[model samples]
Target: MALTGAGMSTASGIPDYRGPTGSQRKGSPMRYEEFLHDPEGRRRYWARSYVGWWQIATARPNAAHAAVADLQRSGAVGAVVTQNVDGLHQAAGSGRVLELHGTLARVVCLDCGAVVPRVQMDRRLRSANPGFAEAAESVADELRVNPDGDVDLPEDLVASFVVVPCPVCEVGTLKPDVVYFGEPVPKDRVERAYDLLELAPALLVLGSSLTVMSGYRFVRAAVRRGQPVAVVTDGATRADGDPVLKVAAPVQELLPQLVSDLASQPDDDSAEPAEALAASR
Candidate 1:
């Protein structure tokens, strides 16, 4: 199984949290509590997220994504569990993908439990607030899209932005159908990931720092089971010292080459270690 993170989508224009080229923006990340309890916080979130929508929506899958798909097609990699909510793996034609964090493709009504497409939400917000996005365009240079697909807009710009109610429940809060930092992943989803890990021969972690327990727990599980755990990322990671093999290179450049070498190996049935595969690069 392949476990991926924000670094997996960095090449596709998404920012990672701890990578060298990671996001460097203002304010704290959105929390589940803040979104659930604070009215002003939700207003701020939807406003910034509205402007940042184009960043993730227009992003195309990059080489790293294609390489993962290639590995899956060749029967090397089986299931993919990604921490990203960007939906790039699907865009890359990868199958059996489980999004650890829920996707931004849709939004949910916190009160009525009605889910709707993000595009539909966007269109509604645009219609409700005339000229708000264009007004923020004057400070376009200041725009920085965060890891969760929200931008760091100035407070002044956010203050006047009108937030719409959920269509299904006129008063229910509309939140992106994703797990925020302070939120827990659904129990069934976590168990499914563990089942996939148990089924796989080795655990290949791509582009994650493993800073958070959401992805790090799998690494610990793999070690307990004596499964090979390989980390391929550009910069330092929380498990930099614990992984069985650590390849410090950009995955976009490394994975494609690694896939080619594995495909061409004479002993195709033999499982080549990630260290050996990376060494060929």
Candidate 2:
């Protein structure tokens, strides 16, 4: 099983939270509690998201994503579990992928349990607020786009911005389907990831700091089960000292080479499992 994170999509124009060139802007991200209770916070979130959504929506799969797909197709990998919500793994042709965090491509109505495509929400927001996108863009010159499709904006502008409610249930609040900080990942998603990890002989970690417990728990579980763990990322991670093989390199440059090397090796029916192979290295 392969576990991926934000760094996997950095080449595709997404920013990571704690990479070498960490988050470009500084501010607290919207918390689940604030979003649920504070109308003003929700308004600010949607206001920034209205303009920033285009960046994530238009992004394409990069080399790292394609290499993972190649590994899966070559029968080198069985399942993919990613902490990223960008849907790049699916976009790159990887199957049996588990999105640890819910995707930003969808929105849910808080009051009515109605799920809607983000594109439709974008269209509705655009129609409701003419020239708003242009205005936000002009002021966002100094702001860095976040992975969650949010950008730093002046407080005054945020106050002036308009937020659209769910179209299906007029009174319900609409929010992206992502797992927010202070919110738990869905129980079923966690169970599915654990099941995949239990079946795999090894776990390959890519582009994650594993700072959050949500992503770190899998690493701990794999270690407890005696699964060989390989980490391919550019910087320090919580699992740095634990992996059997740790490579400090960018995934975009490393994954393609790794995939090629694996493809060139002659197939050996009696070859050792991935855990043994990694442990030997």
Candidate 3:
């Protein structure tokens, strides 16, 4: 069973992109082409994204991630397919993770497709936006508000922030490895996730609303093939009614208990541990 999106990472203090109280009041990030064509839009995105990148990088894996890893280790989960670019799942020790979105831990040049570690971009942002750096530190307290992951800040602060261009090619466009709003999921990555789905009869949706078609497509694929689906997240989902089980709760609290209960179950070679875990949760 694969877990996807922000809900799974909420425990790590990362904000959900969209939900009842998301920053944009809608789910999902900006589109790739928009960033390319709109210079100021790019500036605004990079501003929030640059400071937000620190939180993304420094975030530790929470219980949900650890529990997922434990389930994988115990042979309860065959594989994990994630829509998140955050590397928390891998950091938590889950193997065979199919990253549906490219990782935020890396950068890719759109023109050449050459990838560089995310640290390079971080360094560049720091150098280019020293004023933003000072303002970011001053607003650190304001940034951490909305304990439930909803953050509100001044628009001017966001607008004044600068976005640095690619270091390799001054004219070359750079983007995070993550899939954007309108971009299609890479064909090979989708195929690989489908291959993993074959090993298990259930798809476990975690911490995501599944609003984006790139992710909803996988859930749709699983349902079409008669695989039972179970979801755990904080609010409404694209698959809300269809899943065999739906738990609208914070994943951090639920996942640990689910992992423990599933791990304690009797070893039955013929039994479906994924189903058992899903039912238990």
Clashes of each: 0, 0, 1
Ranking by lDDT: 1, 2, 3
Ranking by TM-score: 1, 2, 3
TM-score of each: 0.94, 0.93, 0.85
Candidate 1 stretches greater than 4 Å from native: 21-27, 267-276
Clashing pairs in 3: 7-207
Model 1 lDDT-worst window of ten: 18-27
Pairs in clash, predicted candidate 2: none
User: Which of 1 and 2 is the better model by TM-score?
Assistant: 1
Q: Where does candidate 3 stray beyond 4 Å?
A: 20-28, 139-141, 144-162, 268-271, 278-281
lDDT of 1 by residue, 1-281 (tens): 99998888988888876755334434578999998899899999999999998889989999999999999998889999999999999999999999999999999998899999999999999998889888888878777788888888788889998999889879888999999989999999999999999999999999987888999999999988999999888877778778468887888988988888777777746547474566755
Q: Model 2 over residues 1-281: C-alpha lDDT tens digits?
A: 99999889999999877765333335577899999999999989998888888889889999999999998998778899999999999999999999889999999999999999999999998888888878877876665678788887788878877788888878889999999989999999999999999999888888988888998899999888888888878887888677457777898988887776666566774333353334323
lDDT of the structure predicted as candidate 1: 0.88
Show the lowest summed lDDT stretch of 10 residues, model 2: 272-281
Tell me which of candidates 2 and 3 scores higher on TM-score: 2
lDDT of each: 0.88, 0.85, 0.74
Error of 3 at 33 (Å): 2.3
Candidate 3 residue lDDT tens string, 1-281:
77578788767877666764323453335677887788776676667677667767788999999988997887767788888777899999999888888788888888777788889988888887777756866876755522121234456887776666667776567788777777788899988887888777788888888887777877888888998888788778878767457778777888787876766666674446555555655
